[model samples]
Target: MQRYFVTPAGLTETEVVLEGDDARHLATVMRAKAGDPFVACDGEGTEYVAEAAEVSPGRVVGRIVQRRASASEMRWRVTVAQSLPKGDKLETVIQKGTEAGAYAFQPFLSRRTVVQYDDRKEAKRVERWRKIAKEAAEQAHRGRVPEVGAVASWKALLAGFAEYDAVWLCYEEEGRAGVGLKPVLRAFGSSLGEGETPNLLLVVGPEGGFAPEEAEQAIAAGAACVGLGRRILRTETAALVALAAIGYESGEMGG
Candidate 1:
């Protein structure tokens, strides 16, 4: 069944409405008729099994058949604080990272970041990134879409470190030293109190990687410098590797 993330306005007490692209996909592309079934999510963790009741050119309404809990959300929330890389790599990160169960994304500027920060055009980029997250969430059957935040500076990024229970800096230097990610995650998990779900932050560098001073500042701000493995990864690949490792460790992936 196809799934969609709907707003409050799109859902009602007994029916669900899909507009624009979703509507066209259902009505024209799928050629759905009355009684065709599909899944609907409110993007607040609630899901419904619904059947098409009314299908039109640009709109489709469905009657709710069953409501149930969404089982796809990860128990531990992981936020990726990525330094801006060149071109459209950030878009790939957000899309694949959402599929990999990232709770949110924060793009920041590191000392070695190459992209010129433009405050004027940032809002549009953020909006597009958010849309990518939404579409990715639906495709992955995620209960909710990951949030895409506006770009922040180095200082601003470190100041928000207090919010997470644990922060890891994915550094190639650590990778070369063979400091594995698994052991660090296991240690961090063991230190948490019983029944505590941790909010984790993974800080990744840009194409040129982090400056030595920037890494020092991050370590001072309660971040533990960790490595993915001996093999160095692209800035976009590091977070996904970390997220997959976390999923396996947390039992979300079949061990």
Candidate 2:
């Protein structure tokens, strides 16, 4: 069954109306017709087993058959604070990172950042990133699309360290100390508030990586510097690797 994320406007008391791109995918690409069964998700973690009730050139209406909880989302919330990488690598990061169960993405300007988005063009870039995330989540059967946040400076990124249960800075030099991500996660678990779900933020540097002074400032802001094993991963690959590491530690993989 195909699944489409329904915005509030597309949802009604007992039916969903998918428009634009979703409608084209269903009505034209899928060749859907009345009574054809599919799935619909509301981005609020709700899924409906539905059947197509109406189909037009650019619209797909489906009647809800059954409702159920979305089990695809990770139990532990993970956000990737990625330093802007060159070219379209960030698009790849958002796509696969969402598949790997990252709940949000924050692209920040690092000391070594090579690309700069002017304020006049930043909104357009953010909009494009969000669309990429949405399509990726749907393809991966994710319950909700991971949010693509606006760009921020290095200092602005460090200011929110206390908001998460744990923050890990993926540094190339951290491997020398033999500090593993698993132990860092365990330590964070021990300190989390009762009844509160553990939340983690992984900070990945750009192509040239973070400057030493920036890493020091991040450490002082309550982020633990952790190694993603001994290999020097690319800026894009590092975030997904870190996410997988934490997911494995949480026992959420290989079930």
Candidate 3:
């Protein structure tokens, strides 16, 4: 079934009102009419089976048939804190990252970051990134939209390490750092309760990769600095690989 994310306020006792861009898409793009069925999510883990009851100039109303838990979201929450890369790399990162099951994305300004953003530019970038994430989520059948947050400095990101259960930094220079992500992942899995959820924060550097001192700073902030593998991956590729690994390791992929 087709699915769209809606706000909780848009949902009433027996119906959901689709407005704004969604309405525009349904009215003009999709040509949706009364009696057409579709799924709607509140982006807070609730999914509604609905059928169009009314279609208007600026809105489409759907009467709810059922409400259920969202199965599209991963059991583990993975947040990607990526260093700003040049060009449209961040857009690709947000799009693909959402499909790979990232819960949130934080764009950071690292020592070797090529893209520089002032306050005004950062806000604009964040808005654009968020739109990409939303579209990606819809395409990926995700029940919730991954949040694209404001840009942060490396130091600011490090200070927030305590919020995550597991923090990982993909550093090329960490090959000989004596830390392997496998063991850490195993230990994390072993410590979890029967149905306990994992909260992971993955830190990916920019095109130039993390500076030696920056890697040290991440390590000091309780993040395990581990190598992706022998051949280095691009900034966007690294985060996708890490997120996929986390999903598979956390049993999110399959039995």
Candidate 4:
């Protein structure tokens, strides 16, 4: 079934209004008609199976059939803090991470980061990233879109350390003794009580990876350094691997 993200106001007591782009997509692109049932999510992370009550150029209405827990969201809320990569790699990270069940993407500029955001175009860039996240969430059947944070300097990101229940620093130079992803997640899982959810923060470096001093600073800030494996992963690959590992640990995917 096609899934779309609608505002809380869009999902009324018994109905959902497929407005603007969603309406057009449903009526013209998907050829949706009245009585066709589909799934949709509201702003509050509630999923509903609804039957189309009306389909037109400007609007497609769906009557709510049932409300249930969102299957797309992971049990733990994870925020991926990635060092800005060159080109449009950050976009790819946000898109894939959203599908992988990340709750937010925080792009930071590291010592090795080469991408310079043009001050005049910063707003537009952020907007495009947000749009990508929303569309990706809809495509992935996510209950809500992952937030794409504005690009920030490494120091700015470190200042928000207290917000996360646990922080994993994906630094490659941590050596053989570097904590493994499995153990890191296992520790987190053990800490949480049954039915408890914790917000996790993951830090991934850019194309050039983090400098020793940067890794030091993160470790000093209480972020646990966790290595992916013996193999080297590209900047874009690190977040995906981390998300997959988290999913496996959380039982969102098979262990």
Best by TM-score: 1
lDDT of 4 by residue, 1-255 (tens): 988888877878898888898889888999988899888888458898999999997898999989998866898899999888889888999999999999999988889888876769888989999999999998888988888888888998888988889888997765356557887788788888987888989999988888989888988898888899877899899999999989989989755
Count of residue pairs whose backbone atoms collide, per candidate: 0, 0, 0, 0
C-alpha lDDT of residue 168 in model 3:
91
lDDT of 3 by residue, 165-189 (tens): 9899998875455455677677888
Q: Order the numbered candidates by TM-score, best leading.
A: 1, 3, 2, 4
Query: How accurate locally, in lDDT, is each candidate?
Result: 0.92, 0.88, 0.87, 0.87
lDDT tens digits, residue span 1-255, model 2? 898898889888789899999999999988999999988888979998889999986888889889999989887799999999999999999999999999999999988998876789889999999999999999989899899999988888899889987789999888766777878877766666654667788999999988999889998999889988888889999999888887876667854
Model 3 stretches astray by more than 4 angstroms: 176-180
Candidate 1 per-residue lDDT, tens place, 1-255, comes to 999888899998899999998899889888999999999999888998999999996999999999999989887899999999999999999999999999999999988888888999999999999999999999999999899999999999999999999999998898898887889988877787765778999999999888888889999999999988888689989899999999888768764
C-alpha displacement of 50 in model 4, angstroms? 1.8
* TM-scores, one per candidate: 0.96, 0.95, 0.95, 0.94
Task: Please report how far candidate 1 places residue 142 from its true position, in Å.
Answer: 0.8
Candidate 1 regions exceeding 4 Å error are 193-195
Most lDDT-accurate candidate: 1
Which window of 10 residues has the lowest lDDT sum in candidate 1?
A: 188-197
lDDT of 3 at 93: 92
Model 4 TM-score is 0.94
What's the C-alpha lDDT at position 50 in model 4? 95
